[model samples]
Target: MNIHKISAATIARTACLLLALTNQLLSACGKPVLPIESQTVEQLVTAGITTVAALVSWWNNNSFTAAAIQADAEYARLKQKGE
Candidate 1:
């Protein structure tokens, strides 16, 4: 084989061996290679506050409260007519 061909083959074989060794090492450790991104305390607190506010607003605007108020007004009207 030519000198250039021999050198290229050597580099290719070395790269493949390195890749296999790295994979084996990673598997043996039983952990992920990449780091996980973590949320900040401020972000968690803000999310909790936003969730609570949304729930409260939804409850206030729900049909049950509106229906109750409407029933009370109707009852008042009936009482006025009876009087």
Candidate 2:
């Protein structure tokens, strides 16, 4: 028997990474990311941000306060909108 423990933050980041990667696959392969090339810049930016965010999240995991603050903020944001 085995037990698997997954934190909410890990799950959230994984989902975000997966979605970003899928969107990047659609955007970076010269497909129509947006209505125009300039507009597609946002998609590229989002891909970059997700990569950075994931790395930052990993780095912050070593710090309880930082990770907790981020998690708390996300929780409050979601709860405010009834998510």
Task: State which candidate has the highest lDDT.
Answer: 2
| Per-residue lDDT over 1-83 for candidate 1, one digit per residue giving the tens place of the 0 to 100 score | 65544588899999899877776688579753432335664787889999999999987734468788898788789999995
Q: Please report how far candidate 1 places residue 78 from its true position, in Å.
A: 8.5
lDDT, candidate 2, residue 77? Answer: 98
Clashing pairs in 1: none
> What TM-score would each prediction reach against the true structure?
0.30, 0.36
Give the Cα-based TM-score of candidate 1 against the true structure: 0.30
lDDT, model 2, position 14: 99
Q: Global CA lDDT of candidate 2, please?
A: 0.80
